[model samples]
Target: MSISLLMAVYNPIEYDGRVKRSANALAEICNIKVICPAQDFSSDCFNPDAFDVMRVLSPKIKIQALKQIFFWVNFIFQAIKLRPSIIYAHDYYLIFPAWLAAFMTNAYLVYDAHELIIPNQGERISKRDNFFYFLESRFIKSADLVIAANQERANIMGEHYELKKIPLVVRNIPPMPKQTLSDKLVFRLYEKLEHEYQEDIHIIYMGDINLDRGIGDLINSLKYLPMRYKCILIGGGPSESLIKLSHSQDIIGKRLRLLGPVPHNHIPDLLRQGDIGFLSYSMVGRNNIYCAPNKIYEYAQSGLPIISTSQEPIVSILRKYKIGELLPIKDKNTPLKIAEYIKKISFSNEYKHAIRKFLLDNPHKSEMDKLKDAINGVIN
Candidate 1:
């Protein structure tokens, strides 16, 4: 049977590992066509031969609110034209429009809740979040299937929406590496580290470099750490604050090197060179508290022991796997605590063993299987 799956996301599908992974996995059982905002769409983002791509062009609306309104409407109209067997909404922003398109097309609607729309921890929900929540609560039950990144978020959504079933958990793990870090790559990395940074203990933070992800804390922690301890922040975001913080701490380039964003393909190799993986998301918002970040899986996959904030799903993973240390992100002392923990855990063999065990048990293939099974059950 030939099945055509249509996926719609407000963000570019290429940079989103969850959507890309889902698209790639669904291709195993069906034809795939992805719909994304045309403003920043790149053909190089995905292999055109594997699946189809459609970019939604928005009218030039000067007002930001009006622009977004046009974008989603265009997105919905585009999805309807394809007449896919499954209409997969990647985020809450697209949930209602996707529902509408699916209803018009008579397609099986799948709502993938990447994060909790409601603020769980009493953080003020913005007008935009409020709107998305409205869309989600209204049409969520109409979905034939719902997916979440982790079980905790799935339970929250199911209870919040009063759904008959909890959303399926599809983790955002990368595909298993075909090869470990090449000796040449390691040698080149070490040569630079040893020569420039005088190489002691490397703390690596990959993904969005922003205050929300605790980049500020990480930067502050560097001052408390010895000169031998250095941090390499990968990825790109608002860097003015981060740059100023690093400079004020007197660690910019000297101890903390912001390499900006690298291509996703280079992450595994680059991350493998690090001594410790840093995963810190501020616990101010419900989404942050319940976040099942892909960086944890990426860090473990690269064989680095982690030092992370104490948050749900993350705390559970670390505690269960015994792969890393978790600290509460609550006061000024937090950075000092992170620095001390890094010193204690650096080059430890125990965490390495735990990471190996974790990798052996969990792979992206299994997560892909879970996603495939869930969708197949609905479509078949």
Candidate 2:
């Protein structure tokens, strides 16, 4: 019989890089179908290539707990009918239903633990997250395969849940770029920014924009840096807060360009134009302390030297690869330190050879093979 894989996630599939990458990789070995929440009513019938999508438009329930139950119930019913050879749960929230569906259908179950806690506001476990954590602890044991987004996460999950084995590590790095910054692509925004900031050293950040992400400190650092230094944020999150942070520095539109979120395919082109990659995850939660941010690889692949906080895997990567500098976390003078470091490495070409060598040594295709191997191992 032909193999079939059913993947479940609670977010809009388009915005979820891990789900997109994993589904595409797994598609090679099994017919893939994804069940995710629709972005809105407009995306209810949305479809993408390689795999079929089943987007559930959440019901209009005022109570948060009841609404979640409604979504889980829908996922279970839809997943059971498909009788997939493998049932993959992408988030902790879907573990209960995805586990139940796998039990009902006798399908091999895969739990892709994408986050330590739902929302992960801080170090403390909220009441809501406690329930989900309990579910994962209970149901994850039954999964035929468990996948962690990063190595540190896998280690933590194994210890946290006391699993028989650690989940497979799959770094969420983007595929090798088909086009580079020098390539003749018709991207008008990139062209315009390159022209406008030709003399400036661009510090590029492409991820969620929020206070917890240290966007405020990054923007404030502009005050210490010279006028030739610029910041470009390319992801979506509270624009008003970002705007407020930019106002005092008087660099919102000029030195700081909040480009918002762009298509995943467009990142390589946009990133290649930058001189440095900026990552500043606040060390408040377990997730932040043990983050395996893909921006390191993304920046390295694009040949941009990184400047980030001293988070675990990031610190280790920077130390090992010598691709960038690490700032002290939670220091009040972080912005000034970022500026100092930026000035220090403004013209250094030392990282160019290292970045080039690293990308050649480690490519996203290798990770894809690992994911495929994990799935195939379970199937066989």
Candidate 3:
């Protein structure tokens, strides 16, 4: 079987978790080829060595109106040349072009939606969003399969698009750990925390950090926390909202440290060092409300409890599994609760096992089997 997965992103595929996992899994049954924009596409540990990578440059992101037009033209040519049995579009942005390619070539079309293309992403709806919504409504049903990151996202897409078939929920979970946990490393980490800074709590927030993810509120909360409590935010994004915290004592490197993005492989080890993880996204848009973020799975896999907001999708899981604590995002007492959770959290072996077991029960193995079946079904 042959499948061409189109991921229209400026981001390199090496860093994209969902695409990486889907490609690696599909490689078992098909010759998986990834199509991306002109960007770095280095193969990392996540790659399965069964796929060829192709790059094309059509529309630079700066020009808004030209993106879809260029994409359709550029993609149709590639689809004809590749002659794949299935044209799998990684998200809704490229679905129109993917559908066109599949239609022209008689290839099966699949829509793998990582997020909702919600109307009014930037606080309000513009002409572009309206146009996108119109296209989505008109063309999305052409896809043979619609896969979403979660059931909530799937339901929204079904209702909003008025599609007859619901999307399948394939969560963006990390691959199981390959390295064995070392007793020496575990003892050293425990000893360092127990003896070095017994009074202080070290917390970490790893992933794309922006104002909406509550980086501002996280920093502001630091001011209210005791001096012994320090936090390290472990990624990069728009830093305009974080500028005010520059003068604060936290940013002086004593209490707060901003380490820019590291290699994806280093995340588990990074999580091991932190006492708690933060998934503090603001529920401003439908995308945010329905988001089933991968960070929670990553944090729990590394044996760290999470601190998140009482939002729709994330709240349900965290509350159900008891793997994390949920709090109001912007309340006066939010910081107080954060500090108390840090101070009171019991990072015991039994608790970590429970979190791991919950994840194992809903492991990413199903993703591979389901994805393989879809591709095979289309090919046969």
* RMSD to truth, every model: 2.7, 2.9, 4.1
- Which candidate ranks first by lDDT, i.e. highest? 2
Compute the lDDT of residue 16 as modeled in candidate 2. 78
The Cα RMSD of model 2 versus the native structure comes to 2.9
Model 1, C-alpha of 122: deviation from truth (Å): 6.4
* lDDT for each candidate structure: 0.81, 0.82, 0.71
- Return model 3's CA RMSD, one decimal: 4.1
TM-score of each: 0.91, 0.91, 0.86
lDDT of 1: 0.81
Q: Per-residue lDDT tens digits of candidate 2, residues 1-380?
A: 28899899888887777888888888888999898877764733435678898878788778978877877888888877889899999988888898899989999999988886633434477788788888988998898888887888898888777889998998877777777335356256554346364588889988888877887888888998878888888889877878987886688888998787677677888887788899878777777888877778888888888899898888887788888899985688988988888887787888887788778777889999999999989999
Show how many residue pairs clash in every candidate, following the order shown.
0, 0, 0
Worst 10 residues of 3 by lDDT: 187-196
lDDT of 3 at 96: 79
